[model samples]
Target: MPERTHVPVAIIGAGQAGLSVSWYLGRHGIEHLVIEAETPVHAWTDTRWDNFTLVTPNWHCRLPGYSYAGDDPDGFMKRDEVVEWLNGWLDTFNPPLRTHTRVTRLRQGADGGFELTLVSADAEQLLTADDVVIATGGYPLPVIPTFARTLDPAVRQLHSEEYKNADQLPDGAVMVVGTGQSGAQIAEDLHLAGRTVHLAMGKAPRVARFYRGRDCMTWLADMGVYDVGVQEYPGGQAAREKTNHYVTGRDGGRDIDLREFAAQGMHLYGLLEDGRDSRLQFAPTLRESLDSADATYNSICADIDRHIEREGIEAPPATRYEPVWEPDDEPTALDLAAAGVTSIVWAIGYRPDYRWIEASVFDGGGRPMQTRGVTALPGLAFIGLPWMYTWGSGRFHGIDRDAAHIAASIIDRVARGSAGSVVTDGATLATTP
Candidate 1:
């Protein structure tokens, strides 16, 4: 084992959240060390699909005092542009990060602090810090259920995380499971590549790719739909929660409706029961729900536009994309035998995996039990979590605002002599973008 080192703050993950914490710490003259499993923005540089682009607009990619500098404000940022921005930000902040170092274990430490076991490319070491920030974000590992393992030996399976582009797929028809952002994007790419595509639909909400004249996200943020911090006021909490409470959002978050896919011969099916003779079926209400979500989203965006104009903020001109439409019923079980989709892409969202933190820090769902990133354990803190503060709190475009709040809390703890302060109790899972 390598010799241990100490720091005031220890941050895990080198993505946007971790970098934001380092940036804030530097501003406050705090000493910290960041340990990253890979280089900064490795998710974008290495794992992302070749055609992947950010759903978020460029203007919102600002973190705390830093902004993604460029000329196109309304355009969606491509993966390469994001990498460039992250690298430039790294040069400016210079966070003390040890690349290729992975956190193997974390547990309660002596004197009310955290003990971290880490393995680098060359050696292993144990270190302790007064505070720890898990910025690993939500996409730590790709999730595939045991049921997926039951596929025929001839069938293929792959997680969306491992998917880079349609060209990377094996020859044959492709089936995309899960209807979330990744699944939707991948399905589109495969379909565009002239591959037969099948989409497996479940209870997942279908969203639109863009709503009205602007991205659905911008409208949501402007509506304060994600601002759980203001929930202390009357009706405020409900309003924020209502905006993004369901997997399906109003305007389906601007997703290309699956209904449209069906019209184009992209079979979208569902399996109600896994039985020996059970066959795939189509469900029409599901298609209606997907379309309805978009209609609701458009209304919400319009309402938000009115509010923005009323508040005197220069609301950006709404940019709209014509969504593909399909006047058809929902489906169950893909006709892969007929459609020839050789592969299925599951675009479901990610779930946080805290298996490494053997400590009793997470809940039944695997999320840390904290009130705005402050854990029950003394001298231990968490930052860069989804809904850790507000709706936009976890996103790179607006994550810094939330990090600043967490940093303030940390600073207050240090000034108060970390031990005396009472850790906040209660659920603090705010809605994040």
Candidate 2:
């Protein structure tokens, strides 16, 4: 038997998504408790590398009750600055938060409420709540391919989440797989640190940091790209699978083109196909991959240019990005021992984890089957999932909207007695009027 506590609402996670919803719940005078496994914003403070900075500009960081008021609105915030900002925001709101408490399990209680099993260093406790908001974030685990196990055990391997700085890795050439934002940035970091970096390219798009004197994010926001909903956008399903464009917050802000990396003497390869012992095989689509990335980047820039002209927006003079097709004559296959590659970093994005959730709220693919944060189950909701509602739903700029929507649903369920099945419109999970 464990200690039992009852609350009207239970919100899991204390990141931006959790805090944003907490702010709204507090404003509504709703009784809720936020449970966090570690300090608030643990992703920024603990998981991120020391040199990590936000991919989006500072002005894009908009929470429910707080907004960035710093001088450099157009600049990107580093890991520490982001942590400090989250801490300040948490302190200002002072929501009911239980730190160091991890929710190990969540199931339906005997009384039709949610029963959460919370574990801490001191003791385990059971909590019952009328409503539960799962804001535990979208990226819970790093995705590594099965072929990684085939690599030589002598070579040190680390996921992007585990990597901190170049000092932590062994002395030798490094091969970084996956050309998403993390892969691109980490390769650049290693290259600048005097390490021979070999980057495996993927299908991630590329975008210039600043275009037409405005940050790329600013232009996207102005063009309502962020507001595009999942169902509303064409090929939304495929779009959701695509990784964010390759850009860096480092060195002020600039485009991190793969061609530029090639120019910087970094070895570029197509996707890692198979690995056995010290030998590795790569796809022979290096040229095709580079061309595809450049085309995607140029298309976005062209859209921005057309938008500026159509709206008669007074922006700085723009320059078109010309692709520099420089094909390296390196072999598609490489022996790690011969190349002196001592370490490998897999910056291949993340996947959602729902093992602790005992309820049947997830689809077959382990993704929560919620419509815009509202689920078919009454008193149950979700926030901070990618493409939850809009293109930016998972980002700081978009979390507030999803949070507010979920908060409203939770409030309505609580007010309606928190019982019976929820009526959803199939596409939009809004309560019947």
Per-residue CA lDDT of candidate 1, range 124-172, in tens?
9989888888888754667665455555545566788888887877788
Cα-based lDDT for every prediction: 0.66, 0.85
Q: How many residue pairs clash in each candidate?
A: 46, 0
Lowest lDDT sum, 10 consecutive residues, model 1, at 424-433
Candidate 2 residues lying further than 4 Å off, grouped into runs, are 316-318, 417-433
Minimum summed lDDT over a 10-residue window in model 2 is located at: 421-430
Error of 2 at 242 (Å): 1.8
lDDT of 2 by residue, 130-248 (tens): 99999898869899889889889999999999989999899999999998888999998898889999888888888888888888888999999998889888886656677888899
Off by over 4 Å in 1: 203-216, 230-255, 271-285, 288-292, 305-330, 417-433
TM-score of candidate 2 versus the correct structure, residues matched by position = 0.93
| RMSD (Å) per prediction | 6.2, 3.7
